[model samples]
Target: MKDLKEQKTEPVQMARSDLLLSLVKASVSGDKNAVRTAVEGIIADEKGKQHRVLAERLTRALHTNGNGTRAMNQMAHDTGIRGREFLAELTPRHQLSDMVLADQTRKTVDQLIEEQQRASLLRSHGLDPRHRIMLVGPPGNGKTSLAEAIAEALAVPFFVIRYEALIGSYLGETANRLKRVFDYVRTTPCVVFFDEFDAVGKERGDTHETGEIKRVVSSLLMHVDELPSYAVIIAASNHAELLDRAVWRRFQLRLPLPAPTEKELAVFFDRHIQNFDGKPGIAPATLAKRLGPISYAEAEEFILDVRRREVLSMLETPLKTIFADQIKAWEDRAKPMGQEESAR
Candidate 1:
């Protein structure tokens, strides 16, 4: 009986080993699709439960890379109304670590990315991963950047919904455009970002809105509800209060990104200075204190402006003097009273 049992198990073990070996070879050759196929075969064989878990992780990684890189390549091939008219696909070059966010915000974003990476494992256990996120904040406060970072972290295509193309002048045309955008994203794993979300997601009962806008809102609600779990949906709004009440409930995660704090500003300046040159002539803490209540985008622009001036002048001026002059100019432009004075 023992010999018969051993004989039956030997072939199954050998097949599993062969499949794993093939997976390794595929990985070594950078054939992500082949690696996924091998992992799928192992999952199908069900010879070792522990091996299945590892295989699932490997399969997910390969799928992410294969889909992401190939989708980027195929973006040019999509010549239809959905591709050319209503949506623009992008490949994000920024990662989460590249941005300077608050500790809590950083943790939340990290958790969201981790959940996406483990989405397959969650689905295997009958759990749904959080894919729908609502980003609410003032303009230039990193809402769009966060969306881009999410795409990079997931290794997925980033699709931005263009309201100009989506909001049609004719009756019912906008809904048709919306459907096309949804249909395009449904075919792949992507981060579909709706910047200036208030345009379409405004409160349905607002008296100022037209009947067509109302219909669009209803259609949007239905589509949001029906979006697949594999596709990530991110909607960013400068005025969260303008969004429909129903819209708020549809998102699985809601994050409010405020302007950079003093500490974050210091970190941002330090990072930019380090990247520009190995040494910093002016302390980042001093600059951070001087640039009060600036957005993350503004800080980046300021750094770039300083770098540009330095390069243009061939380092003839002292770095401290240049930085101080730039800060004073920025402060004058940012202040309403200073603008009024300058006009006179």
Candidate 2:
């Protein structure tokens, strides 16, 4: 009889052990929601009042994870709008060295490093970091890439705001949604990125705009002000002129991304072709200079296309011939656009 009772309890004990293991795994993986859920399950299964109470305490502790953002997390939960849907969690794979930036852009990167270090020390001194930043330039100039690099350097959760999902058709709904996002940010340490910011942050005084847009802008400005310094807010805009003047003042660091210079172009081309076995007969400097003014994104695309063609040909053709042929094709495609620009 004693042996049978021990056997019965052994399964229960084993189940409890599994639960504890799951909780530890979830915590280590930075899944706060999973941790909370597991704790709740443990509390439900626990027979003793003391054990249940202990489990409840653990659940509460897991809610914030020492970030003091429990209130914001709770508010986000109460809103019923899933924060994960609109806020994409990013794990950066690229480092600063991988990015080829211009001299002015490099200065901005240095400033970001300084701010991050200062923020860490200031937290101990009861102060916060200057976390608000703005990236302005034409499309495909590496604004988004810079934001990712900053997030990686800071080692924080990178949350990109999906404007399409956040914006609503109903009156006042958009403002409410925006408020929830801001509330969540207040409770966590993350890099919140708002790409294509002009969609919602346009000038309020435009005659073509409606009252809804004005209210949305007001809500955005208010949230920007209320956000804690622990959360880094990075907004990117291709049309910087469209943004409200009030919005411009909110960002502490404003970095402008420009088209790649001749030197940058050469470096980019060299990096792209470095891994390939075949040598481009033409020098990278000559090709880069001939390519004219193009964005880093365009250069990457051109190099990739050239490489793809070379691979398809079974490496029979020299890379230099392939590079020259690709460049000529691209130039021919752009000739019409260039002519139109000149006509204008």
Candidate 3:
């Protein structure tokens, strides 16, 4: 009787201690939701922190599913967490919404939902409009990240298909590989993202060098046209001008992800600098002013990198040298495309 009483009291004390510690850790880590969820789960349980119990059950479920990443997702699904919510959790937190632009050319989650609804209505009425979208944009403008975010929003598996992986270096092998890829998608409900889609679907021309590209494009067209009604396909490219006409027809939705504007860059800079310990004289306005013509990713990196250089400088050395190096790195990478064009 004495032993059991002691054991019961021990857990209550431990739970309170852990709860306080977890709250502090979550705050320090900037994981507010996690802290809230943990507190709520403890209150609901009305006993101890359920971390070990949940972890054990999760491990058992993984064993049942062959212990793979897919198994973990399946476990999440089995536990009543929606697949889309799970995917969203898998995405990096910073690029969730603030980084994305609200504009006509780009598609928002709201717009994608509307488009899907319309596409469904048309298909029900026997007008099979393709939901296969193509996003064209420059590198580092968040093309691939946007694709993943969309899938995360939709709560579906975002499977990225490398073009090189699909195209074999042999006669008729490309088509065979494509068939296998399409076949896998048929079995899995996933958002299929084809990055560098131009490599496989570029338009053909009079040149003899276009033969291989032509054949691959034809195979792509056939597969896309035959894709079942439920699948969502997203193909991305930096070279939109090169996409074949036939392939364009297969994509009823065309979303162009443009570079971030000055305002968006400012938002990115502020959010990133929040975590940095900097008394650097550069105010947000001054940093934003210096970030003219730079993309959001560039701006975020610039602030954090400069802050890091500032914080890590030797106590004896002048800070100007470190600041100069940061500016030099940014200028080297941020030279406008007009310079490259003029040099040519």
Candidate 4:
């Protein structure tokens, strides 16, 4: 046994906090060689403990981040959307309220990091990691907002693939236009966000569908398969089933975003209700009961719309009365069926 003076740090036994501290030290130093050396040291010392796995993970992370940077740089040169402008472009159109994150989209940003690490691993290993992800759910949910959040989380370029720019009427032209996008992904190590994926990657089975879509799909698949691990391709479609199976397969991970629950709605309203001057006649619990099947996006819009109506009201009225009609309509729509159904 080793003497008290020569203590052994168990790699496998290391706490998550310790492992993360090791990683932070590695990342902050900005030296891959140093990170690699530190990881190696940890692995060597804690060969039988929890630290070994943590070291291995940290090594992979550093490698992926480095490779992702290279791929993003190449992509920038290819697409001409790099540097400060690219960062600015990636910023969200609307800022996310901290309350909203807590209320509705908990752990979303964390999930994106996991996704990015997966993407980076694929790249480091010379495999095409489908970073192209789409969030599909009802409108007024935080799909687009989540996209921005992902960009911020990864600290990479985020570009909104303008649908109009890619959709063209000319024959064979649309596919060619899409090539520019794939080229951008190849050049930039960033997230290419397609807000409404269905609009672009529509079903190719229809008779009215031109061969152009088929070609576009083919091009997209080819590029998707060829994407280096560092690039992320995220597409959000309300109708995911409509996407081609091949397209679906290309994405390494598919997260199904669902509507907010009553608890979530209560949290959502609790945060935003403060904006109103007077008491909101409807309680949060009541609002939550009414916001059934409401997506994160809808919840936000509803709050904003309510505020707008109250502020713009012509007559001086109690806050509750000012928004009485809308509240009633919501309540009527949300009336309980008062029945229990078994599993379908």
Question: Order of all candidates by lDDT, from best down to worst?
Answer: 2, 1, 4, 3
lDDT of 3 by residue, 61-132 (tens): 433545443543343333332212212223423334645565664445456655443443443344433457
TM-score of each: 0.73, 0.73, 0.59, 0.60
Per-prediction tally of clashes:
0, 0, 1, 30
* Higher-scoring candidate on lDDT, 3 or 4: 4
lDDT tens digits by residue: candidate 1, 67-92: 45544323322422344467788878
Judged by lDDT against the true structure, how good is candidate 4? Answer: 0.62
Candidate 2 lDDT score relative to the true structure: 0.77
Question: Candidates 2 and 3: which is better by TM-score?
Answer: 2
Look at candidate 1 and give me any clashing residue pairs.
none
The ten-residue window of minimal lDDT in model 2 covers: 41-50
lDDT of each: 0.77, 0.77, 0.61, 0.62
Deviation of model 3 at 100, angstroms: 3.2
Greater-TM-score candidate between 1 and 3: 1
TM-score of 1: 0.73
Candidate 3 TM-score over all chains jointly = 0.59
